[model samples]
Target: MYVAVKGGERAIENAHDWLAEERRGPADIPELSVDQIKSQMTLAVNRVMAEGSLYDPDLAALAIKQARGDLIEAIFLIRAYRTTLPRIGHSRPVETDKMACDRRISATFKDAPGGQVLGPTFDYTHRLLDFKLAADGEVPEAATAAPLQGDMPRITEFLNRDGLIQTETPSDEPPRDMTRQPMEYPAGRPLRLQALTRGDEGFVLGMAYSTQRGYGRNHPFVGELRIGKVSVEMDIPELGFAVEIGEITLTECETVNQFHGSKTQPPQFTRGYGLVFGQTERKAISMALVDRALRWEELGEDNLGAPAQDEEFVLSHADNIQATGFLEHIKLPHYVDFQSELELVRKIRSEAQANTLKEAAE
Candidate 1:
């Protein structure tokens, strides 16, 4: 007695219209401009670009506006748009040593080179609401200082000189692109790092927290965290030299973990690394912790079967778009499935009642 619902197209159109209206809010209020979002909501735009795996700030801003401030939706829009663009030659890896740092800090040392600059951070800010911002939305300019000169050396380099940490040999092999190919188990470190960088911020943060709470404890110390701009370069075959293409803001994190050594090897402090687009310290630190957790096998530590240690689980469920789609699909029409279940239930009850009656009569 069931009839399939019709007029799906009309329903969808109406729903979209209503959504558009909701996005605009009242007519009296000025509609938020993409430029305004790009400037004021820089963090949101940064997150979209980072998770979207695209470095375009303008597109990220547009996506943010179109998504009605939903960061995940903005990331989805950016990701979708990224797939349509043609891929040219890849750029050479950026050099963090030459970064023009705006914010830099280290927990392991009180004073380091470049001198621990704290630029535009909310770490020490009072949590009270500012009514002045609500009325005029104007922020007063803060005092400035002279910029630091020369390349700031990494804290790990100091340890490296003394042979206090494991030496990592550079590999020239190109990394596997997860977008172009299906993800496989036992993924290389580069693939895992890429997955962690683009993974849902909250999901990655939670996983990192779990490790701190004894799930896969790695005893991490923030060796250094830096935010800065670096020039991107691409090698030109015709020119016979690499040329600077553009500059991008990036956040880099290096975590010093517990020492791991055995009878065959000398004891040395371990390291975990994270690098991502824009000034996102939380994601960067979380990424580093998770990276170290995943490196347990190679570091000669026990697997411990923790969630963060499980590469497949972490990478597969990290994408909010994929997770949200599968989760939200449950709301769709499932009339056929429900009908089948209903009939099965009725048949089972009827048989049970018939058996009871036959037993009584006998």
Candidate 2:
């Protein structure tokens, strides 16, 4: 019989000490600063902020350092730290139309209002590695262009004006906060989008890919994708007006999906929306796709039994923290369960042999 071993506190301590050393690497090498990670590894910090559901770059950088550059682990650290902070007040919803955009593009239209500002993207860059970066670790200054002034109109708005897209009626009902409240099945669009914004990037990407491969084909076109800094506002009860809290970089994606009209409705384009912290276009686009897929019921489309269409499946498995906990738990001791299974297998084999022998003798 296998018995559980205890008294490994000292061993665990030593193992953690060794792990710290390993994370630091050679003693001769200079330690990496949190600022360095924050500024240089901007994308990583962005991902941590997006997944962790916190926008503090400094804290995200520190979490990245503490997590030994493990993005998921850093996200976990940020989430844990966030839970400890007191909630003073809730911020009024941000207005993306007022965003100071750094990058904006639309695939649905050839000539958008902003004229497809590429801005700081790797889309046109060659995949070839530059050895100069490894030796010098210095980036050359990019050529500057005159910044686009004034608010750029949304591509969806154009469609809406023509009545070519389904009219989205604003609801006065307050959105359910997924963080505070337990998730319920048949979730509303707002709650589903919230889950996707904080969902595991890879998982969401895969689900989105599945949709593209005809799992739940909803002929999606990137209506518009904008990356920018938007002012966050808070409605102060005493002040009688919303005040600007702070600015946060966000990536917003609007996917225009095909929607043949239902019995009562006219044929018009339906939309899927995604908004996440920082410049993560891939995640934003994937989120939009998944969001549209989850809207099957609302759009009156036939549920083709796709994974992305299944609300319970996507929402339940979207969080990396919960998925990691359950997945990594397999490493823990399961000796008793294994032993019971082993004994049962042995007994079954023995019985089978005796029956085979009896049949041969007969």
Candidate 3:
């Protein structure tokens, strides 16, 4: 390792200046505003928020812009900024049953209580690009519908009524935040969920795919997936009560899995849950599959030695920021490490040559 940075101070400053110049691009082209990224490039902003463990779309958009659309770098920026913020208070658990749903669907039931609002989605849309969008003319407005009059019952609640699925009792205890403390092995469901929610979407998706491919088979079906806005509330000591602060978009997924019954309990369909910061259905689904895989021990199912079933391995490597750090560090000066390797190689070669000479004489 070098005593300082391999690049001198002037070279580093010059490189940063060059980077800024490159980030700006052509002088003729207009610079992208943060609002454009927030509103138009919405999915990218959502991903940054979800993976970065921060709920600010505007900030995520800014980070995206600053990082020149490199999502992982944007996440790193957000995480660094998040660590500097003061810990005032934590929000109460959001109630998904009461969400103002934008998109809602159920795979288990054709007609749920909510009646399957398609909302704005890519599911039914043809992949063919529309040239009209490039022309920048006024787009046709979407049709509006009246909001549901009453509370739309959750799909799982229906199965729960008949005791067809395992029951998850609500607890008054607060969920442990993984950020507050070091991650300990054999982490609880709360910690695992926290990690999965903020974990890299690709890594989680791969693990989920492995499970589906029979690596750690747990027959999984999407019971319901919903995307919507939920109110965030926090209690203030001075106010003496919880007050609604703001609303944030969220995606929730519940998977119904194969029945796991034991001598003490009757056969019941199992449950796997996923909740993320935004409308990231893929990540939510992947999180649920991996979540189910981790529940093998709790469900009395044998571990199949799959990566998904191994909580420590999955959780530890799922963070892209951490993975990138280890990967990129090798690009730095490795003179000390390389010099030792070079010396060992030289010594081995010299010894081999001496042996060869002695053999020739014999």
Candidate 4:
């Protein structure tokens, strides 16, 4: 009486229809416009952009609305859309010094040349939920003013001035692209940053938290954290000049760590760096901490066998898309594998019982 399932095509079609209906929602209620999502649910859009490795906040917002407010699903949509985008060209390395910064802060120093500009932050806000937002209450707009103009020198630059921190030689070498290439063991900084930029916020936070709790502990100070847009340019050989391709919002973090200099050199501090796609301060900061922890050996510090110290472990598990895909895939049919396992366990138990019976009879 057993028959193979034959409704897969119909089931799939029906599922797709249901999903489309759900995304649109009740006919009476006004559909959420992309602009509303972009302006109202900005953080979700930011996260999608951050993880999707796409800089278009509007596109991310649209993706969020299209995906029915599922952030991970929105990221997947943006990534899928991005994958088809042809690589027009590469850009000149953006000089952070030239960045028109919206928000910048340094933890190592109390005051720098630019002073601490607390531009557009929710750091001190109470966690209480606002009921007025449900009714869409109007709020007064703050008076506009130009951003703080003075240059805030990097905190690490101060250490570098005194030869107290590791000196980083700026390289003209082209970094490897993670999306275009498979990740190899013992990843370089460029590759690590690529993965961290797209990494799950919660996962990176946990790894960073572990480090703070004395797991592969390194005394780290937020050497610098900057959020701004960087212009991307590519040189056209025919034109014989670099041309602007696009601009992207980025959050960059650099941390200074204590390192006991080895036989090769004098004792000095080192740097751990993090760079991400958008205004993801938490992720960028966590990434910086984890980055430093991974450099224990390079800095002549004892490994202490910390989880954060394991680069392979941290990089391999930080991505939400990868994690969710692998985890949820277990729900797919695996009857054949389950049957094999069932047979093997039964055989083992039967053998053990038989052996026990023989011993008892003897």
Candidate 5:
């Protein structure tokens, strides 16, 4: 009798205990509280907020701690948690032009109107590891200047003034919510951008790098990169007017890429855009590049058969939750399918051996 292994329950319990021990590390060491992760691991928390499509850094940090620093698992936790959150209401469209920017830069111009402010970036830092940080050392606060007032002008607006870039008028129409709906083929710009913002950073980076490596290469220049907070206003039906609900940090990148003119058209610049839910410059920039590459068809440019250029390819595979869930599910037992394959292989081999013996006898 072929008996299946027993004690599955006990095995699972022991495995869980081991996992919990591993997650907490040595008992002598101080336990990591969720608040500590939220404040100390700000960058990691920001990434979770961006990719999980939620703005709660606290929740993201908790998810991270719970997941034992497995970022995809953290994202999954946030996504699942977000699904249960009650829908209060939709907010008014955020005006990026009126953003209170902390970091704003443009690669297209040497000196833009507002001037570049490279705030709180690790870009200039050497890659050397700091031994002091091993003991959780604190950095001294730098001198701060008073907040700049008045609205910051968009870099794209300047190009539009000169008739250099394609001019786009603002629409009063409401944009579709991608999370609430299943994505269909031939998605609009809003839908595409939403997918890219919450996309896996590595996948986005690879796609962007592919474009630079001659696959759908469209000479790109960073038109603008801005990190700032914008008010999320919600309309109160009883009050009859929209009021400030809350605010969220965002990173917006706009890329100006070369656009070829058709026989009857004049050459003009087209745009690739990205907007993420935190200060993530690299992800935002990569997202813009991939966005531009995917716009080849819309801008009347040739499709160079790049992975990034394929809208369906990029949007469909970008999310971490979808990718990880499908991948890790394979670890679950599929003995029935394996048994079928096992029987088929044995039968085929046996039949081949028998045919060989028959030929030898003849």
Candidate 6:
């Protein structure tokens, strides 16, 4: 992975120096702190954490500061840092149904079980910029309400009761860990979900959007989309039981698709799931759509020959870090490669002229 340049050390060092200066900006204005970024620029931090496959807000904020607000660069830094940390033990699967939901909405149903909680959404707001922030950073306090009460059962469960949607077949086999092992295809749904959750948001969103635009159409309705904090539990060897390690905010999405009938099974609704870290509703919803699209074969649905349906294509290119790394390598000095190409072109041109002159003489 190391590319050595003969006399580029001083140039590289100077570039680093200039980068640091640019990151700090003007000396007159007060410098921003990691804490301020951690607290204030919450969505950006969450995105870094999600894409970086790390959950530390402080680290994400620090990376953002170091990258000068370039989120992809921040993600690259976080991913590199994560490689140095030692692995402990795997945590139990998060139960999102028990989540302390900050926002929950369903497009398919009029009112879901727990009712619609529109917590802190920009859905109804006008897109025009609120110039009040340019003058001063003050705002009115938000109204508070009592905690949401009731069992947060999944909307798919209702369809499942009527045998309208496919039921999940329980498995004792441990799902593959893509982070621990090298990615191999054809990957199962579990492995694909792993990649999708940590995949680049923009790419996944675009792929999902393409599906809506008639490529591998899945007539998906938002069964439910909820964002909130859920407790993370880990099984302790010493304690011989699982303990609540901490709480993590997450976004879970479920999409309901049109009914389909096959040779063995009757016509039933299909469901798509997306469970991701932080309150990334857009990514979560996109993930659900793509996840369903990828399940064409498993669901006994016909392959519509769409990009989203191709697991290898989607999973391989979804990582922004890998993509950026490969693309950025071209920026490095390629003098020798260029010189070889230049010589080849010159030789080809010279041979062509010689042949043309010989033909003219004849």
lDDT agreement with native, every candidate: 0.89, 0.90, 0.89, 0.82, 0.86, 0.89
TM-score quality measure for candidate 4:
0.90
- Off by more than 4 A, model 4: 1-7, 148-152, 349-362
Shift in Å, residue 92, candidate 1: 0.2
- Per-residue CA lDDT of model 6 for 162-272, tens digit only, reads 888888786788998887899999999999999999899999999999988888857899999988888899999999999999989998999998856766557888888
- Which ranges of candidate 6 are over 4 A from the true structure? 1-7, 146-150
TM per prediction: 0.95, 0.94, 0.94, 0.90, 0.94, 0.96
- Two-way TM-score contest, 2 vs 4, winner: 2
All-Cα superposition RMSD per candidate: 1.8, 1.9, 2.4, 2.6, 2.0, 2.8
Tens-place lDDT per residue, model 4, 1-362, is: 22334457789899999999999999999989999998877778889998998889889999998888889989988889999999876777876665567778887887765766666778888988988888889876966456544444576788788899988876577888999999997887777878887898899999999988899867888878888777778889999998887777777889987777775657888888888776788888998888888877656567789898998999999988888889999977776787788889999999999999999999
**Candidate 5, which segments miss by more than 4 Å at Cα?**
1-7, 135-138, 170-173, 263-265
The pairs that clash in candidate 2 are none
| Candidates ranked by lDDT | 2, 3, 1, 6, 5, 4
Worst 10 residues of 1 by lDDT: 144-153
Looking at model 6, the pairs that clash are none
Top candidate (lDDT): 2
Model 2 poorest 10 in a row by lDDT: 144-153
Which residue pairs collide, candidate 5?
none
Model 6 residue 19 CA deviation (Å) reads 0.5
Cα lDDT for residue 314, model 1? 94
